[model samples]
Target: MAIFEKTPQTKAILDDTEKLVCTIANAQNINKHTEYILRVHRGVSKEDKWNVSHRYRDFAALHGALQAARRDLPLPPKKLLGNMHPSFIAERQIALQNYINEVLKHTILALSLNVRCFLDPSNYPANLTEQALQTVSIALRGEGRYELKGPLPEIGWRIRKHYFMVTDTESHANCLLCWQSYGPDRHLCDKDLQTAFKCLQNLSHPHIDQILAIHNLETGAYVVRKVHETGTLRDMIYGTEYSKSYLSKYGNPKTRKPLTDGQIAHYGLQLLQALKFLHDKGLPHGHIHPGNIAIENQKVLLLDIENTLLGVANVHRPYIREHRKTSSAEAIDVYSFGRTLYEMALAETLEEPYCDIFPCNMSNDLVSVLRLCLSSSSCKHGMPTIESLLRHPLFSRPLVMGNGVHSDGATSLRVPSQLKEEIKMAVAVMEARLKAEQKLVRGAKREVRIQEILGSEEEMRKQKRRAKKRESVWKSTSSLAETVRSQSVSTASSPTPPHHTSDAPACTNGSSSTSASSAPLASPVAAGGTQQTKVTNEAPATNGRSALLSAICSFDKTRLSRINSE
Candidate 1:
């Protein structure tokens, strides 16, 4: 009986598998400064949570490191003053949260070593490269068959996986050495792992590259394979730049050199033959992609066939788990092969798995093969087997080698009866595990879809509320403008009253009389039917009063004199 127990490292791997959700939960004041406590939640469960405290300087350091790859980071600006204040700290905390969220949102930045270490130091240590090197060195020291060359840095996309160049001591031929964590899903015990490695070492086919050596370690395993200087098929189609980051490698398709129709037909047929051979021996190359294919002397050599036994997560696991139809181990391989073919045909990556419409320029026969593997109808019913694909019209003709050798004449692969039985059992176990994982993934996807719908509806509601508020504000402003406009119109249209001095005594007569000079002031108003009161005030004054006031006094004197004469 085999026994398996989930360790802390296994739990950590499981936690890492979940989508990361980071938030600055709160800010704490310590040592006369503020430190933000970031609550990192990996999954929906509250139990899968951890907190990391960081200062503004820490965020700045992360920003500086990432600025080269990502220019538009939302890092908060540094504050020279009042940074320690509560309000400033709070605002900075939110800004930092947004910055980290933005970083995590991008796949490239999130996978970068700097960002990973910053978010989870315990999981992604700064000396991760050194540690991997040391582990491989120790393993190689024990097995003196291969000489370890210097480390190959950032060569592949998998973060946990490390690569190193080595030379086979016996053959004196250079080979590639790779080490990756056993992962959380590995159920095989040490004994089974050893047996599996031995089976893989003995396994061989014309189109499949041979595994020189494989060793299972405590935390992970390392595999050695012959290194082709031409690099992977991806490098051949899309030019290689090993120095560039993994994300940048696929960033530019303009530099791609697409294969001709003949080349596709030839290599694709060989790939199918290799897959068929594996199936015949009761094995599945669970991992298949352009990155795992290499070509030398016009022969298509499939690499990384041992990944399945190593128990590392498949590159297309996310896509595979999403569709229930792709639950079987063979179906998964077919789906992956379809994707690889799509890339080869188009010289462009298929961003999504399902593609209904293909370019008109592509060959009809090629598209037909693709449809068999990738069409929704095919996925619903069943993807064609590798043997059937080998019989397809596109690959119906025999592939002739450069040296006048026909590929169809290659000898069939043979495996020991005991080894074959063991492989069959292993494949069964893998299929069962994959089906269980698919179930879990489907449920998780359904929940995610629900949350997205709710979030979208909430966002719509918020937008409507904001629009209503703006409409109300606009209406109030328009009404206030109209009131001011009407007041000005009423003030301009009305007639002005005759000028009077409150300090002057009341007229003796029943009606008060105005002086002649006051007539000029009223004349302009009477002619234009507009107020000139403001214009009259601008006129030069006599003594402390205007000319109109002096005229009023003169008229009053004249009126009194006239009364005396009467």
Candidate 2:
């Protein structure tokens, strides 16, 4: 007897969907109610744009509940006492923007059952929305998990509710990092994902922040990474480093404790090792600075290297790009590392364009290392290599270690304890002297303030031309340095060496002049090409023309006109 068996209906698999990005369009006050106008979209296209409005109080309540529910997540601090003040309101608005970023990051990290319910207001009981808006105690409900079939079942993370422990379904603990992903277009996102995964997968080091997983959704993918609690090295040096607007709202501390000489040495050695490894594998770190370094467990870790492949330019500051353009890819790493070393050694921030003389009162050995590293000319065969940095005297027990006696016909390189102690004391004295000098500089800050007031478009254009001329002078100096390096290399190869000062010609006051040695000149030969020609410092004819150019470069038309009228 054949019996007709009823088949069970199965739920359809959820398709991968595009990530939703929320940007604050405006915030307005209406009848004492603060309304946030947020624009949401999947990608750059305007087809699926959604503009949603919510009361400021709703965000405050959401923040409160999120704090209570997910202690693991770090949300921007909420302002309670002075919410109506203009300054406080402005600050809160920026914080709210940052809060949206954090929320989106968290949602992208793990889209579990609870996360879906938290995001979709429709899933909430009609009364729950009202309750959530009213009570700070009400937290979102649902667990975070992969909606589609995967290798593991229910391995996900989510914000906790009433119970501190996640329910029986959750298989993974709450993660510390809030991952962010973007898809300008579906095809582009896929292409970027594949490229990023391919590049990042081969990189594995103790100092590098490793990619744990790359989770793909229908329209985008999440690149999950781990971050330390100590935060970025930039945060350690400066009180905080964020967007300019964010910084203006919440003033960062002007100064922070600089890493000690011993600490810097330790960090440098490890980082140098990582650089050598990367370079050997034919991968340029692309970015290397204190800001990109992460400190965790008293160790130095590299962060944000994967962004280069994601189409996120490593152009943090304009000058960084300009400087990097002047050198090869691997050399950029060395050049940036040198700047980072200078900052760490001095325990202060550097104003760029590559200062030849540092403000810090450090040992000459330290200074020499910095000079070589800063010079773009040093990236060649004759310059100090990353491997050579491992054996630098600065990393030795003493800053200056004299020749040691031979041991079994070989020299003893080990430093004595007494010598090490003396070097430490010497560094400490120099640091104290620098701190005193810095105090004086800080005291005269108000007197040094000279704000330029540009009144007309013509004046603005003149100022721009002067700025361009100034940039041209610096570029000439870089070319001069490279030329000197090439000459030195060629001279070294010859049997008889001629007397040549390796002192790099400096561009001061927007004009370049060599002392005893002739510096190379970089003049515009074509729209994009610069012709390098040798120029002597003592040449009267060249000096006359240079002086004329300098006069034009330094002239402030508006100021001169006002002075003439007076």
Q: Which structure among the candidates has the greatest TM-score?
A: 1
TM-scores, all candidates, are 0.70, 0.38
Kindly report which residue stretches of model 2 are placed more than 4 angstroms away from their true locations once superposed.
1-172, 176-203, 215-221, 239-251, 315-317, 375-385, 396-566
- Give the alpha carbon lDDT tens digit for every residue of 475-532 in model 2: 9999999999999998787543223335423345543233212221111211112111
Model 2, residue 213: distance off in Å is 2.1
**lDDT over C-alpha atoms for residue 411 of model 2:** 14
Stretches of candidate 1 exceeding 4 Å from the true structure: 1-18, 24-34, 43-47, 56-109, 241-254, 375-381, 397-422, 448-566
| Candidate 1 per-residue lDDT over residues 442-558, each given as its tens digit | 687788899999999999999999999999999999999999999999889865756555775454444345543344345443454223344446665543355444333333332
Worst 10 residues of 1 by lDDT: 554-563
Model 1: how far is 553 from its true place, Å? 57
